[model samples]
Target: MDHEKVNILLVDDQPAKLLAYEVILKDLGENLVIASSGREALEVLLKTEIAVILVDVCMPELDGFELAAMIREHPRFQKTAMIFISAIQVSDIDRLRGYEMGAVDYVPVPVVPEVLRAKIKVFSELYRKTRELERLNQELEDRVRARTAELENSTAKLRESEQRRSMAIAAGKMGSWDWDWITGDWMWDEGQYRIFGVSPESFEVNPANVQALLHPDDVDQLRKAIAEFNSGTRAYETEFRIVRPDGEVRWCVGTAAATIDANGRVVRVSGVTVDITERKRAEERQNLLAREVDHRAKNALALAQSIVRLTRADEVKAYVNAVEGRINALARVHTILSLSSWQGAELSKLIDEELAPYSLGGQIRLAGPEVQLLPATAQTLALALHELFTNSAKYGALSTRSGRLMIAWQAENDRLTLTWEESGGPLVRTPKSRGFGTRSLLASVESQLGGQAQFDWRAEGLLCRLEVPLTRKTAASPAPGKFDAAAAAELQRASG
Candidate 1:
């Protein structure tokens, strides 16, 4: 196969040897540069990109080793291979030093011209293959980049077409608006003006005028949505309140997509708006009904848990019967809150009922911030606390007349921490084997509450600590009114 041209630098002090090498390698089809001295060779190398160098070891000013060292020092010629030629018999150490100076081979002079030519041919072929491979790799990379850019453009166009279809569908049912960010112009479908209860001719649909129609409380949220889309941080899907021309406040869902220029500047946002006043009212009613059902289900589950706890108490009849009785008392408190719709249960009421069964004239002490527990969390927590109370009443603090139980809870930064400490009870130590109640407590705290639970069976008494995320409890609370459907679809298409 044909090979790319290789530039060879042949350095020698003797003119006869240089001419002999040139004549021998003339058939190799490579470009050869001849230098009579080490200084002349260095000058030739500075001007030409030579792939290999053949240098005479015995030179007057700079020897082959010294010239090789200089070539290796220059980063541009660092990888260029050097071969040392010498008339003197090369020593093992001297040959080692020449190789260390980056000589690939050594040729004894009074040279074999054919052997020298063959070595040059091998190196030239290798260099040609390397260059061809690099060229192919660069071409492959260019093609891959071009293909990737084409795919991205096609994907963007598909998404834009899908968004336009969605806007058309939404427009058939409700109102729609398309904003041209480049020109600061807004196009509104007829339904949009009708939904806003405004004459299409009266309004010049633009972001500034749209802001004027938004409820004061929702303006900030709408602005934040637009800002997120424009910054490419997120697509816009915001619900905000818009006041109609008739002076009535209505909820509107806004959806929008940002179009970017080649330089990635936001050029436009296109989307649709929808009216969802009736849907919002229906959702509110459904939420109320769901909360009621959840409360009742929690109460029923609590009762069932109490029954199971009491039945298991007989299986270990050798232990005290007070464990089962205390569990029943906890269930009764859960039932009372369930009857009231589980908005929340008072902390004091929960404690009072759970301890009523183990009362030696109200010896248990409860203190800390008075907070209500959400229905689901309160039910599981009550059961876990009931188990702890039962264990204390039988084997630890609440078992004796001098024993006392302290229950406390606090909320901070969306986390609720509850601690149970007992004093003046029987000496406590870690159990040899964990019981069902112990496993239940760990599971309830870790799985349901999404928090950590610590149980320390210290010599003083049994201490239990629990931490739970508070967001699960307060999600039912209503927030300020915002947009509904039409604005949401509009924002979605604009963002898409």
Candidate 2:
């Protein structure tokens, strides 16, 4: 767009009319280009960017209509304003034709300079504003192009940074999450889905589904942590256990912070989680071993005290032998328990250890279904068997070659029933008082095991019947015992 004074083209075949137009429009402060014919006007149009054109209606080869039509045909001059001036009156059709050729107005004979100047002024101003608007639009487009290039460069750098961060997260096997504070909706990354043992596509990400992965024991603690975070009392950092879909319980450590708005209200919470199952299991094993050491120490002390308090001997030598023998019986049970990590001892093994000396002798007979007893029960039962074995060897059944002993046991619900029957020995009668051996046997079964012990002296033999509970809850007072599923399975196998 040119900022110079707008060019106004005046075309007339007669030089007089051309001079008249020039003089009239001269004060309008515009450049007037004169052409003697329609052809001359087109030549002037090519040289200058014209604002308006006033031409005579009658001409030799190219009239005003033809010149206007020719100007309008050019793309550059399509908006150039046109006005027709003629000495002869124009018909309505001719006026309309001039208008159709894009003429702005038609004046006959002498022209009014004021009206012509006013019309030219109006068109010139309109062209100036249109050019100014085009200039502004081009400037805006240039700025947009420059800004778009800068934005493209920034976007490329951002994508590279995100890729590097994603690789780092994957290599670490760490999970990340965002939780909407108000909606309870969850957004989890691929690593988070992996940690929870779920497929990203298959599961809906939500707080309720995440809670489903939490171990029942850890749910309350998780809630408390969330409450503390909500109250701004703590940044969320806690350890918890999650039960995977496959029933594996895994430990996890999570750390998070709440995003707050300007009003100090929570906007969202975001965090990282890591699976620490292996570390947690190692710690649990260490604790378990510690507990086992403590339990074994207490048990050893209790057994030693019981032995010293209960033993009744005539001499120091006899007392030492008695204590040693009881201790040896306990040690044998310990050996059996060691094979099973001290979970329990087998009843059959306990019996066999007490009767080892008499095992080869035809006088001893053992018959019983397989039964498993708690370590405490096995220990006491072993001592009682030892006392019985000693008695039978001295006066009951095993003292004679023809004498025989029969031991059998059965288990039902929580109780175990064992019978010791002796026969073919010297005639036995009911004793008036109990001996140290008898008293020890009674105390072991009745006091220590919290069971019933009975003795029957018949003419041919001595019979003993012991009823005890198979679990450790029978000791002291009744309580829930740690039931060994493995032991139960062994019993089932034996029965089968």
Alpha-carbon TM-score of each model against the true structure:
0.37, 0.50
TM-score, cand. 1 vs. native:
0.37
For candidate 2, the 10 contiguous residues with the lowest summed lDDT are: 478-487
**For model 1, the run of ten residues with the poorest summed lDDT:** 478-487
Clashes of 1: 22
lDDT of 1 by residue, 1-496 (tens): 6656889999999899888889998988899999999999989999998878999999999989999999899998888878889999989999999989999999896789888987887777777777788789999999998999999999999999978766765654467677787788999977677767778778888778888888998889976876786767535777777898679987778777777888888887777777877678899889978875664555455445434443333446643454555456556665857666656676666777777778786668777777777655665577677778877877899889888888888889878888999888888889997665666567656655577889898888888899987666322232211111222232233223
lDDT of each candidate versus the true structure:
0.75, 0.81
Deviation from truth (RMSD, Å), model 1? 25.3
> For model 2, what is the alpha-carbon lDDT of residue 229?
71
